[model samples]
Target: MDINIRRAVIHNVSENNQDQLRDTIVDAMQKGEEKYLPGLGVLFEVIWQNADEQEKGMMLDTLENGLKQT
Candidate 1:
């Protein structure tokens, strides 16, 4: 089986409104399932591509702090 995960993820959420998007993300994280990781990665890829330096720095800092907690 062949699958384009990034494309599929984008397609699934591209039309979502802000509230819907937030719900989707929150639900995905709350579920804590391995299958959801790829979708999150795709979302993060979009964020990374569009984020400015300051935003990127903040994201990295947040990720760093999150890892420290584990």
Candidate 2:
């Protein structure tokens, strides 16, 4: 079977409102399920693509700090 996960993720959430998106993210994280990782990754990809330089820098900084703790 052929599947485009990024496209599927985008299509699934394209119409979601802010609260709904927040809930979806929170639910996925709280579940701590490996299956949710791909969706989260796709969401992060969209965020990365749309983010301005400063936003991307901030994300990188946050990730750096997160990794430092682990």
Best by TM-score: 2
lDDT of 1 by residue, 1-70 (tens): 9999999999999999999989999999999999999999999999999999999999999999999999
Top lDDT hit:
2
Q: What does the lDDT read for residue 58 in candidate 2?
A: 100
- Global lDDT of each model? 0.97, 0.98
Tell me the lDDT of model 2 at 70: 100
lDDT for model 2, please.
0.98
Q: TM-score, each model? A: 0.93, 0.94
lDDT of candidate 2 over 7-70, digit per residue (tens):
9999999999999999999999999999999999999999999999999999999999999999
Which ten contiguous residues of candidate 2 have the minimum total lDDT? Answer: 1-10
Which lDDT value does model 1 have at 56? 100
